[model samples]
Target: MTVMRFDNVSKVFYTADSETVAVDDLSFEVHKGEFVAIIGPSGCGKTTILSLVCGLMSPTEGKITLSGDKKVGYMLQRDQLFEWRTIQSNIRLGLEVQHVDSKVNRDYADDLLKRYGLWEFRNRYPRQLSGGMRQRVALIRTLATDPDLLLLDEPFSALDFQTRLDVCDDVYDIIKKENKTALLVTHDISEAISMADRIIVLTKRPAHVLTVHETHLGDIDTPLKRRESPSFAKQFEVLHRYLNGGNAV
Candidate 1:
């Protein structure tokens, strides 16, 4: 099923007539339970595309439709958890706000914490957890509401290289295990290649779809494995050229 779509979308920005065109005539569709990554140079309006999907910003022109008005969950570069709240409390905050707190929901939250190895630290503050664990908590917090789709904006960009890969594995495991569709926006081609079933490359500012590459990573299905794959290097160079505004080499 088509879970999300952008039909000839455009986003225009006017700051005292600055009039920047963020996205120009972009059209695409994301199917259910697929991982679609959008990669482009800085100022290519990748985040703007995500904003339109989440209803944070409306498209200046064209139509965007969600399959059923499903709730969207966004995970940013930072974990963004409160330092004051205990892990359990942090997870429960959404339920509290929605007035849906109940024995079942709280138990579900506890199950996720325990399954993800945060159970022992459930009473600890956010500062007590490592960066990866904290990110996991942030993801669980987003999952608490059970959104139909997730928009991740360079969610691992803030971490060190090793930590980022390990966290990528962690998040990949979680999201796949739960069978959630994810739309990831990042500037890193390797990260995109490793995480996504398909990749959508955009142009410079006033962006349009440069290309969309569908990948089949074989038995070596991992960020690291994909990077190590023989095709990985060639694909990266192809994307590198695309972002540079040349024909795919």
Candidate 2:
């Protein structure tokens, strides 16, 4: 099933003296329970697409549709946790914002923390957690609201290489465990290839869909495992060439 669709969607920006075309006739579909990654050249308006989907912005032309009344959760490069708030409270923040801080929802939030090995740090502040743990807390916070689709915007860019790898596995595991559909925007080709079931590559701005690659890393249980696949190098090379104006396939 298609959870989201962008049909001939175009987004234009206007200033007093200038007009910019960010996305041009972009069209794509995200299926239910699928993990998708979007990769493109630098400043190719990848983040803008996420903004449009989450209702932070509107498209200039065409339609953006979601399956039914799907709720969205967005995770950015930074964890953006409140240093002063305890970890448990931070996880509860989304529910509080939506004014759905009912007992059931609160219990669900607590359950996530407990199941994810974070119950012990429930009383600790964001400052007390390591970078990776903080990112996990951020993921738990996003999941607390029980979104239908999750949008990740270069979420692991802030971490060191080792920490990023660890966090990627954690985030992927949590998302899959919850049976959530996810769309991730990353400049890292390797990261996209490793985590995504399908990858959407975009052209330079005004951005449009270039090609979609289905990663065939069969039975790879984790992102790290996919990275270690023999096909990983080939996939990386293909995506690298595509991003650099070379034809794929």
Candidate 3:
């Protein structure tokens, strides 16, 4: 079943005497439990797509629909954890915000920390954790709200190369294990190819769907494993060409 659908959606930004079109008549569907990544040229309004899905901004035309209650969990470019709060406290922050902080939900959040090997660090502040660990905590907090879908906006961009790969594996594993649907906006071609079940490539300004690629890496157990597959390089090249405005081969 489809969890979300953007049907010919377009977004426009207006100033006193000017208007700019960001997304234009774009349409795509994210199915339940599928990981979809969106990649585009810089300034192509990639982040704007996430904003639309999360209801931070409304589209100028067409329709955007989300399945279930439309509950979305967003993970931004930074970990965004409060340095003053302990890891556990940060995880509960979302529940508290929604006025749903109850024993059951709190237990669920704790269980995630424990299951993900974060129990030992629960009492530690964000400052104490490494970059990858901090991102893990951020993912836990996002999951605590039990969102129907996750919108990840360059969640690993701040990390170094090695840390980014490790965190990519960690995040991908958690999302798959939890059976959650996710839409990621990223600029890294290899990252998108490895982590996404389907990748949607967008055009430059006035962004629209340029193409979509479905990945089929046999016997790949994790995102890291997918990267090891010989198909990885091929897929990366395909996405690279498309991002450069070249025709898809």
RMSD of each: 1.4, 0.8, 0.9
Model 2 CA deviation exceeding 4 Å by range: none
lDDT minimum window of 10 residues, candidate 3:
216-225
lDDT of 2 by residue, 47-116 (tens): 9999999999999998999986679999988999999999999999999999999999999999999999
Q: Write the per-residue lDDT of candidate 3 for residues 1-249, one digit (tens) a residue.
A: 999999999999999999999999999999998899999999999999999999999999999999898899999999899999999999999999999999999999999999999999999999999999999999999999999999999999999999999989899999989999999999999889889989999999999999989988524868888988988888888888888878767
- Rank list by lDDT: 2, 3, 1
| TM-score for candidate 2, residues paired by index | 0.99
Q: Which stretches of candidate 1 lie over 4 Å from their true place?
A: none
Q: After superposition, how far is residue 122 of candidate 3 from its true place, in Å?
A: 0.8
Q: Model 1, range 199-233, lDDT digits (tens) per residue? A: 99998889999899886773564667677788888
TM per candidate = 0.95, 0.99, 0.98
Every candidate's lDDT: 0.88, 0.95, 0.93
Q: How close is candidate 1 to the true structure, as a TM-score?
A: 0.95
Considering lDDT, which of the candidate structures 2 and 3 is the better prediction for this target? 2
Error of 3 at 7 (Å): 0.7
Question: Model 1: which residue pairs collide?
Answer: none
Measured on C-alpha atoms, candidate 1 has an lDDT of 0.88
